[model samples]
Target: MGKLTATSAKALTAPGRYSDGDGLELLIGRTGAKSWVVRVQKDGKRRDIGAGSFKKVSLAEARVKAVKIRSQIEAGIDPVAERRKARGIPSFREAAALVHAEQKKGWKNGKHTDQWINTLTAYAFPAFGDVSVAGIDAAAVRDVLAAIWLTKPETARRLRQRIRTVIDWSVGKGYREASLAWPVIDKALPKQRAKVKPHPSLPYSELLGFLFKLREKETMGRLALEALILTACRSAEVRGALWPEIDLEAKLWRIPAGRMKGGVDHTIPLCDASVAHFERMKAHKRENNDLVFPGTSKGKSLSDMTLTKLIRDMHAADLKAGGPGFMDPVQNKIATAHGFRSTFADWINEQTSFPREIREAALAHVNQNKVEAAYSRTAYLDKRRPMMEAWAAYCGGSTGGNVVQLVNKSA
Candidate 1:
């Protein structure tokens, strides 16, 4: 096969089809249009791979493209199918944006969307920004996370998780056929080892002293703290508690599942002390506002940080007064406000012989085995009544003798 000059090929560009001198062919139609195509056979089957329009791809470039196609044919690969596959995979940036748009519709608020984008921009985008979605592999992902795994392990972990989610989405959408297997799946990335920190919890011994001081303070901070401890709830749950959710007469506080971290409604059985506290709060309730602990001058729920600061202040005051400060046996440090739940858990475990499931149910911890939990949904509120009463008495410095009455509202 000899080479075809542009002059010779132009001479054949009249109306129908003709071949270039090297067995690569060209087709010219009545509209003065010219197209270059390569004819190749594999497995006794003929196929045509379009090089490009004559005006765009020059003879030399078309020849090079044809040679590449011919090599692929010799390797038993279909060039047309390979081109289609390449076009299918989007760039990392484009695929991520598409995934973001699809996920944004289900997000409850704009904050969720903002968080998703912020995490990706801060961590994932920096490493895989320009890489094609199809080309990313486990090593590429490891390089992204390994850079920040030492100083920012938590951020790095979140970045890996988000990258996995994006790549998984791309695979589902056909932008990629396989996931970018994460190398940091079970082990920490290189140059970084997982740190062993103490679990956050308060000790049962220091809880009463803390509550005693909190009761004496008589501030909103103090009230919020007491409410949180009495209810055995997180700061967010106590801060966001509303008057409508409370039943003073029935002595119950129904925390909605949406407000609960575990997404299950928890019925807190109020003891006499908690009921008395609610009675005192009755005079403070606003006519239009619903929050049980509204912020000063804002008429909305108090900030979650308020109780934490109050706990810190109480610790400082105890230190100044030469009194015993809040201590956490588990962490061997000053207790955090959130650690009170652990204190309550310890009390239930040690001070009372309540059944394990009842204690776990009170703390809203689900059973790992679904079938077991489904069979045990009765919650044993009657059995839990005495336990909570004992806890309340311990917190209030009263003798633990009250036989808690079980007013079955369902009856």
Candidate 2:
């Protein structure tokens, strides 16, 4: 029998180590916290390995573990390595990384790939990042969400989904028990007061003057920004523009599935104004470089900050001249590059007679309504042509007055 009994192990509360014989020892911390430890010798090296807490792991349980450790050592196994390898549970943070690395390649949006992990890192990591995934109960999950559930409803909802995704991934790996108790946790979390925040957008009425100002000092950055506005495409789409994608003859810019935000092929109709920007870029195209708007780096495109800084400078200049400086009239915030898409959308809804399908096509927005998306297979390249030309016309001084004249290819 071991030197210490269950009653004796609990009674020894003083700060000291007491041997239970056969390598097993009871350790009492300075704070009187008691735990079990056992020493083992293998390969001429001896080390102490923890069995568990004295209170939770009774004297009998500690003796049993000590016997198992000795048996493993006798069998020429590194008990330390075996114990580490058999770490009872994986952490939530570790599970998230495994899930991200495995699934990120399928996500087409570059921003989305980063945001997937970023949200977890920002919120979930603080609460139970290092805690064992298997140990996480509904209370822990509820506490992680309670702080933001009511204040930032949409973000919290997305965070909840992402948390559940990691938990579900852990469950598949056998790191968690059953599925997450989200249904039970949901009742504990406060009901979110849904608040939707849209991108700050310049008013459509002020777009004409904004476009005119944008064209005043013509640089590669301005040209790129104009292309983004005229085409109503996203920032990365315009910045990463390739020469081969542009077709002056067909009046189309074909963006392949890999390059598009949605993993679907998109075709953009080049209006009279958009073609002019491409024509200007044609003169500056380096023999080795294929980027339509190449940055200072040999083959690299301009950074997003380059365009952002350009807008900021223009805003400062506009404010200096006693104007609103391209402010989003509603939010009273400066207009953003992405906000130009919102501006395009607002103008299309208010001023234009173009059908909803055609407008969505112009912006390359995937319809959330599955039924509508099923019926709207046609890209309406022909219809968007006139609509874009008119948008260009409206963006210009009047009806197509400021647009660059079409160059005759016959020459």
Model 1: per-residue Cα lDDT at residue 324 = 61
**lDDT of model 2 at position 139:** 76
Predicted candidate 2 versus true structure: per-residue lDDT over 85-104, tens digit per residue = 58756677887898989877
Model 2, residue 318: distance off in Å is: 0.9
Per-residue error (Å), model 2, residue 208: 1.8
Question: What tens-digit string does per-residue lDDT give for candidate 1 at 1-411?
Answer: 536777787666477767665447786856678878888887897756677778888888888888998998899876655764668767677777888898677544455467777877877777776666765667667777777877887576557756877888888877664564343332445645536343355666567667667655456666667777776778888888888889888878888999988888888888887787777766567778888777776676777666667677777889899986776532336776677887887667655667778788777776889899778777566777777888888787322233333222101
Candidate 1: deviation at residue 267, Å? Answer: 1.1
Off by over 4 Å in 1: 1-199, 397-411
Instruction: Give the candidate number with the greatest TM-score.
Output: 2
Scored against the true structure, residue 190 in model 2 reaches a CA lDDT of 71
- Identify the leading candidate in terms of lDDT: 2
Clashing pairs in 2: none
Candidate 1 TM-score over all chains jointly:
0.48
Q: Rate the local accuracy (lDDT) of all candidates.
A: 0.71, 0.79
- How high is each candidate's TM-score? 0.48, 0.50
Cα lDDT for residue 150, model 2? 84
